[model samples]
Target: MKPPSSQGLRLTCLLLALASLCLPIPLWKDRDSLMQEEKAQETGGNLVLSRQEQQLNTKLVSLKKMEIATAMTTGQFPPSMHFFRAKRLIDQSKVFNIIKLMPKGAVLHLHDYAMLSVGWLVYNATYLPDCYICFTHTGTVRFRFSKPHPPHPVPAQCSQWVLLESYRKQLHNVSEFDRSLVRNLTLVTDAPEQAYPSQTFIWKRFEEVFLIASGLICYAPVFKAYFYQGLLEFYEDNVQYVEIRAILPTVYELDGTQHNKSWSVAIYQEVTRQFVKEHPDFLGAKIIFTAHRMLNVSQIKEAIVTAMALRAQFPDTLAGFDLVGDEDEGHSLWDLKDALTIPYSLGVNLPYFFHAGETGSLLQGLLLVLHGHFHLGAVLTSHPLQQQNFSAIILHFKVKQCLSQPQVLTADTHQSN
Candidate 1:
């Protein structure tokens, strides 16, 4: 059988070549569009939808349109309006109610420090023993959990620290006092336009609120409770998993025993382990160890190295690294390329989840995409915030994605609706 005649072999080969020519070649011209369709499927486009699911999706589309029409006519729940301002209006939307009822998989982009409510902080942390409170030169509030004696230096912003427990008892209406504290620590207001006149002002106050809240959270006992409570809140929201971005605050004891960065990372692992053991349905959480974007390249590089070391020690909990801050005010991705490229140069597979293109300029966002091409990592772009070129970023950089704009980092309600 193997010893067929050369003539017969030639005839068979010729026949096969002719069949191949007629079979079909890929249409290279449609490659771009075809790839895009596949991309859509990868990003929740649901190409293989069942008939029932498609019908439900169509109904959802109609509901969206109906809601949009009502919103346009009533000027209610405007997308441009602040979320806090329009929260009541959102409550009235049937679509929003339906969405709220749906179980969420994960909160991809959360700042662990700001995950819980100001009310939660008031009741949990403020009620703890040895807690002290004071007011700044301006009307902003301050908190600390150290002894009320002269040893631990008081912040100049807080003139005199009074025991929070005693202060609460002095008030006729403790609830009202706690409510005032909540207002002091949050951006919630009857009029956001008057309170937060400019973007700069809002961010400034946003930073201030974190500083105010940090005092209670930095306390050792409170730190542990805060982390557990944060996980619990996400669990209640039907979020089985979370990937948090945090600056890893210095946790201190009432006796002034402060822990290091490594200790903080360990506690995160410990708390998460305890949480998962109790509630197995909640998959778990990861921390994208973060450095402030405003830090120098050298500082950030140091941070990256520290993150690499920490990730080595706590591989499961330390998810990766990221640069976090208000994009408009902090160092741009281009400016930090030296530091950002370190992971690539060192041949480390530590994935970056940098909060890029979070600024309000599309041009700036696109420019950030150019610098980010040097590093193989994801850019957490704030959508339509000068970040309209996400497709361009993904296509060019071959990036992964998640919506992690660090909203929970502060009360940045002005931009949301």
Candidate 2:
């Protein structure tokens, strides 16, 4: 098919303009009002707005009244009108005042490290030792020092990890594969199955980045800055509560002052308490302890034991457990089911959020226990060839079992209704 001629495009634009004017007086009036405002600004005179401007302003007020009516009646604005009014409100610089009137909720899937703003990282480094950073031969920018100085300099570099001045400016250079890396490592993707063909390959790369960043983030004083950064990001997003999945305990000091789960929990709690005190809107935080599948039975047990202990100390703050690391090369939660059972029994009250049925598993007796939970019947469907329903079924079974009877929030008449 040939492209439309220039005359055809001109006619289409005119028709669309006429159609818009005929449909809504507010649309045409709002545009006319904007033109008048531009003219007034250019002329440097305080001339009264035209009838169109008055009509547009009146329409805006009417829309605001309708917003309140709809929200009161249905608990939310109509989807179409909501976006239109919201855009106008924000453009008028009243978004914050408007949002402050609404009740906000919790933010999920916030990674603690990336939340740190560059401003905080640089500003705080001036007062802390080991905040000095340099580019290593490997080209990865990391914090380490012979003396205390400014935070990692703007546009500084390390092996392959360079801090760009602007994320948007550098975004164009990031390829689709790199974008996938960012999403997988950062927990930005919702449905990993549709996002990736093999969790085994994706997670292998994920663990490698964690290993690399661990050493880079462990420098003294970075933890404090990191915590604050995460808090600030949550604040900026209008989140009242945050349940960040932090892997802080995985990082260690240069002299081997290995930060354990306990230390990480202490740091997290301290920061959370201080932040909530300063910012009353800031509610609370919880932890999701993640263990590497590459760990041996003993190591896995120790990790779970640490998680259990933390849960005991901070019952409300510590949420649950997760398994991370290379899925293909290492033993999965299934392989360590017997070893994990002891901890599960001991921490029976603690919740479990296992990552199950992701990439490359044997089908032979797959019916056997998956991470100590048996798979029941699957919801079979048509068109088996094109769909990954077989894989999704197992994941569904894992989620079902994980959220089953034991922690089903049983109602108790023992307490007042």
Candidate 3:
């Protein structure tokens, strides 16, 4: 009895814990009955519903449940299937029409170049009187607007410049050529995954399409009309407002007159104003000035300065600024910090709407978050993250205030195609 030994004390505590665990606690004898009772109690607290409302809710639930069950059992395709696969079945289903009838909110992330149909671009825009076409050695085509001229020294990469009208006449089937051109200008294919094996490959083709499209739409006459048509298309789809990501390239006239960036921005403003006037139901639109990330530091600074000037000129229409390119191959945001700081130094506020984390890199995403301190408010990304690291970054850094709207994933019908 000279004080209990340590081992004896441990054995005593263990026996006491086991005895407590084995004791019959006053828990519900029938868990199923308890669950039903609690559920009834909870439902009893809810507001009373009419018989018709209850029936409608039940019917909707049953329909959704049946759809899911059928999809699972019969191996039938569901609406939630991959967009490419679902799109194939769209023509046969009412879902496409249902979506078309739905009122879509402001389309905030559309590229100006891709707002219209490629068929319209090739057939309508490129079919203009002065429109010129050049075929590259790499089996791609480029279109532009210029007055008719005799054949001259052509670029080493291009075969020669010819009138699109004449070129169409030479083709055995003009309709087939137009269709093939549309296919080249878009990602529509039988097997998209096979055609575009990797992001790098796909991005290369994407940029190529932009190049081919820019030549057609960047013509002064077509540029103005393009904006109008784009607005009309969006309005017809029940989208009242849109924010277009635009690269304000130098627009050229058929007479070889080059218009500066300001002229292009002015045209956009005028066209948008006129469209809104004509379609009073349409709310409005804004432009997010974008520059290629492949630009040098000087070029980036120039783009920012140009954007600032446009913002000053059209304060209501110029929304923000962004760097657009294949993020995987472009320079990092940190690398261009000095150039990006120009707006701050010049006493102007050009808030950054940067494309970040598209490559799904934690380091790149963190850099973007850190840059948020200097007016980097929103990031455009398509990558889906399941990790908690993104949330952890936001919480740990207290970046909620800096990232005002968080990440925006731009979705367009053509992207799925």
Candidate 4:
């Protein structure tokens, strides 16, 4: 959507002012005096406010007024609307109360690579590709880049180029991509109105980088470094804990021996424990062993077994199981229910946090199945709840719900997703 113009913002502010009359009389009875005192504190000796600050203050007043009015009329706003509206109420009249009202306990299903800010990856890690490789001239999320067989000598431009990391620390701003590598590689715009984009478009580029990063993480030490970096990034966002969904991609070891998924899990668990000990603010972290949705029945069974064993070996850290990837073009989770039952039989309370309703049909089918077939202990769906039985945290693009807040690991589960 296009950014609101100045005129639009002013009109919205006016609407908000009229809406403020709907607030309970008690809330506004002392509001004028409170606002006067605040204005005095902000302006010091002068009553005149700067143009920009005046505009902002006016906007906040109008927004809170509208919120109170809506709440009075509707009884309560939808939780999502509450969050969005509260974010706009910058004056802190009832900010604390609003936060308390929202249930943002745990975010369960975030992809690791996508969770970190792009500025960090590019600037902090120096993640720029030395060689460009495009999969096609059109849209694609995966591509092959040249291996730095002969690492390029440090470029002289490095000394002059503005570093993304330094800019993050100093200015805390990210540059929006003006052009994508392809018409749809880093974006897929179908209409002219959608042309101008923000960090959201950068997210598409970030996904492409994950293919390279996963390969890099297969190395024991590289995995350690990446995990450490990811942890720090999460903490910066006030997340106290995380449950990373890691799948060690299939790759050959330096010695020509194939390092299978099980081996990768073992190494990942060990590293996770050591990392947790190193960061005190972090209460804990865990793994929800994931199987690719595209994998066949046999592979799915083996993946579940791998997870079961991991749970036995690392009970506290291996919390559950998940089927990851796009569900649109694959077999439904119900299609493999028989094999899924195997994990439970083997003493792995590997609760299924399956990615069910990620697609339109899949979402509907899974909702019906969860409602009828199994008394789903908890369910995560992109759709909002119709009853009080479920609680959820909606991510930037996905939503997660479970029977009860999955044992809070101390970190925001939303951060994990």
Candidate 5:
């Protein structure tokens, strides 16, 4: 082959440069532009809105704009603030009144012990005839319903369990005592962020409060009424249906007679049924039996067995089972895989509603859903990592035939902060 001349090489290079200029260049979007595009795509798909729907959406947008404007102008806390701070401002601004009137489809993630007001638990539940309380050395308060008497002599456990009635009598004003009790039972404070420095600190207090309430709520007589009152509270907030997560610990009667797990479940069913019957407008309530994540494998297995039995007895009202505790400190869902799979292996229909990734690890949550095969339900915290991983998991699993059935995926926004 003959080599090209210098002029021929120059001509070739010039032609290549001209060809490059004619070729189309690919365009790349920045992060902000991509996000905006995604947002538009999401909103643009539902362009054909009904007249009523359009009016409602317009009203909502206008209200939100007004709220933001007011917050900015007055230098008040805005709706965009942390939930606790925003809630405080909302309460003071009376904005919560509007929210209260709005119809909530279903409240699905409330812890049963924390649903009712602390004031009601202290003033009403603890004010019962035979209620007693003991303050532990660790600053945790425990309540019990026993026969009306003086403090019990249990020096080994603690000094004694004092009758709430006696304390009420000793106090100059019972209302003040009730208020103090409310403080012990709730996380409500002027500065919650300061009081609870971290999630660990707050969750410790949260668990302690539950323990305090459990002693009173686990009493057989109070169990039924307390559940009913909780339903009523949700009803007042325009929540028609609820699924409450409860430990379902063995309950005790006022006479100190202990009731088995089955009895406690029966009580739950009865109370829920009666409440629904009376308040016909309310859809109904279901119990999601929860086991502590801190429990050993054997304990978890036992809890699963009991939950399965309860489901058999009350299939209609027993929604499902869940593992509840601070996800960061407790055992992961994988640790109790055998126990979790028992219901499936036994041909029972109990579904899993495991709390995963509440601590901030999306990878941990993804493993819980994928490896555990929790196709029925999964509760995840709304951290950015979790959200991204969740979206990936959905896309990853959506095509699998085994996961074809509709699954419940709930995000716990409460822990996002």
Candidate 6:
């Protein structure tokens, strides 16, 4: 499949913000209105530079000064504005376009299910052989595959399945149906503020979309295509390598044959191998195997053991383990510490790469960082990821966050910065 457009790549900023642009201190916008320092602080101002890098730095510094002056004159606050609003103007940004051309080393933490465009999933995946679609009673959609004519059981929540290709034929305006399906697969909407009433409501809707997309992506053929598509998108964005936070989803073939998580892990490795072979510049990708955080101690331990076994087989492919879900509602690091210590008791050397502090719990935030010291040391996300939301807006993330407001995080945003 062809890679997504630059506009789709711009959404890549949200993942980077949620994954990396965080610190214990609240992220501050450096607009003249917010701060008035004679000399600005850059992360590596003291570093020695090569001639080429120095030239690039001089040019970038001039551009930065010009942007700050522009914002000061217009008082538009492009870089300091919320990215939800800033994104509408990102295409015209020189800084973002240049960053897109620069090589980014690694994406240490990004959800496997969310790296690509829903438009791709809607138009591409549904056209495959034996694919069927059904609407759940609660109005969510699901996809599955079976022999073209088989007596198969439908999900208990859903109505009977309609072959997607045939269903498209029955539609007078297939484009409208496809658009609706895209909306079902993603939280994108014109009135996201109206769509997401509360944090709990929004999180629930987010999980529902995850479930819907998993049905399509977890099918065997689509799994390979989707993984490769994600890789292609990152490669196009000049990201050299990635570390995907993946669930060991149960993939099923058209013949109703179910494959375990090991099959899924192997496929990830195969896709990465194929991508690196095609694009030798790519340093290759790794999977940080994850499980739901809401699971009990027994279930969490089983997941760790599962990760250990997979890592022994695919040492490079299966990178580590983590528990993924809503941190506020799910069991915290303290609650799951006993289970997290399983790798050590067995001396299995499994590492962790967990995402935390998206919600506003000071205790949870401390536990997540402290959990690293407790065992299986991990890193934190405190670096600036250059994204298209205007250059100044990169520092607009709110780090000392409590439960996030819909407006600040963006109504459709997956998580807080």
- In the range 262-288, model 1's lDDT, one tens digit per residue, is 998899899999999999988988888
Model 1 stretches astray by more than 4 angstroms? 1-75, 78-80, 147-151, 360-417
After the best TM-score superposition of candidate 6, give how far the Cα of residue 136 lies from its true spot, in angstroms. Answer: 2.7
Task: Give the candidates in order of TM-score, highest first.
Answer: 6, 5, 1, 3, 4, 2
TM-score of 1: 0.75
Model 6 C-alpha lDDT per residue in residues 1-417, reported as the tens digit of each score:
999889888889777776666642344544552453432345554467899998997988887687678768977555454444555656566776777899876766568788887888988998787888888988788888778564367777888988888889989999999988988987666665577766677788888888889878988889999999999999999999888889878888877788998889899999999999999999998898999988988889889889989999998888777778887788886788777777776766676655554554335535644655334232212212212111212222442221244323443233434
- Per residue, candidate 4 scores C-alpha lDDT tens digits across 1-417 of 999999999999998987776665657767877887777786254566789968866876776688778767866543322232333443354643444444343445555444454444334333434322223233332222223232223222222223323333454333332123223222233431244243334333434456544433444444456666776666554566666666656544323345666666666666666766887656556666777777888889888888777777776766667776545555677676666667545543555555454443346445644554333443323213211112221232233322111211112332444
The better candidate by lDDT, 3 or 4, is: 3
lDDT of 1: 0.73
Backbone clashes for every candidate come to 2, 7, 0, 8, 0, 2
Candidate 2 — worst ten consecutive residues by lDDT sum?
402-411
Candidate 2 residue 174 Cα shift, in angstroms, is 21
Where does candidate 5 clash, by residue pair? Answer: none
RMSD of model 3, in Å? Answer: 9.0
Please give the distance, in angstroms, between residue 72's alpha carbon in candidate 5 and its true position after superposition: 1.1
Clashes by residue pair, model 6:
79-393, 360-402
The 0-to-1 C-alpha lDDT of every candidate, in the order given, reads 0.73, 0.53, 0.70, 0.50, 0.70, 0.73
Better of 1 and 5 by TM-score: 5
Per-residue error at 211 for model 2, in Å? 3.9
What is candidate 2's TM-score against the reference?
A: 0.48
State the displacement of the C-alpha of residue 116, model 3, in Å, after optimal TM-score superposition.
1.4
**TM-score, each model?**
0.75, 0.48, 0.73, 0.50, 0.75, 0.76
**Highest TM-score among the candidates is held by which one?**
6
